[model samples]
Target: MKTHIVFGESGGSSLRLALKDHQTNENIVVVVDDLMWGPIGNILLETVQEERIKWWEQVLNEEDKSDSIAYLRNTYKRLSDWTIALTGNESFLFWVGDSPTEYTGLMFLLANIPKSIPVSIIMVFPAYYKRYGRFKPLSAGEIIPEKSSILLKMQNPFLHGLEKDT
Candidate 1:
């Protein structure tokens, strides 16, 4: 009955928090499993409900780094469909990589998602990270203010919620 998916480089934080909140309110149940990134994965596992955990175990079995990412994409594709079927109405609030230009799979799926399904897509503004040689998270709006650029071209599906700093 709940539809929420979060992806990205630290982009999953908002989605994870929303899931936790929903669980607390007894409105929904969450299964938490994440692609290994860093400390965030550990924190998420500890915080998410045990019953909702659906981890991509194949990633662990793969020796190649690219294979792991591929497994993640395939896993989500399968899970997304299952989640939609299990719940009658389908709604997805996914926060993927701050920039779709960098994350090809996320961009492809978002664009190619069936329009007939009445799916709601929200792409969170990217927050710069230190690992990318930046000391802090930077907004795509700030980095590339030009509206002509592809980065700023996509309209946020859930603009109202984003206005409040979700």
Candidate 2:
């Protein structure tokens, strides 16, 4: 059986929807992280430790500190485990938007995965118009629930390489 891993922010909702509605035979693993909006100077935990501490101090109260820290640690582990599981044999796809946050997430994944593991990126823009009509580019959440069928039907989908724009 072929396994296709899809990674994105917001818990890979869009990718999950696309796979569920279309590619039922393939095993799908979704790695969702909000790394794009956070302080990610480096993919290494050590490099981002200071930033993480600062963020925790600023955003979390004393009562919530322990719980929040634990949550972050757990999330980091999950992200690391899933990312490391992307071998060259399994297909990989990254769904990202044209935003700094999304781009940062994509960069992080690109840096972590081995060069031999070919990665395909689907870039979502904020403003796009269809041939039949004009519509604003939808966010991942909006697109998944509203237009997943369209995504499933897409042929020759425009995919970019990880090396091109990073």
lDDT of 2 by residue, 47-113 (tens): 4745764676687788888776776666566655655565657545555555665666677766755
Clashing pairs in 1: 31-52, 31-53, 128-137, 128-138
TM-score of every model? 0.38, 0.63
Question: For every candidate structure, what is the RMSD over all alpha carbons to the true structure, in angstroms?
Answer: 12.6, 4.5
Best by TM-score: 2
> For all candidates, what are the clash counts?
4, 0
* Alpha-carbon deviation at 16 in model 1, angstroms: 2.3
TM-score, model 2 to reference: 0.63
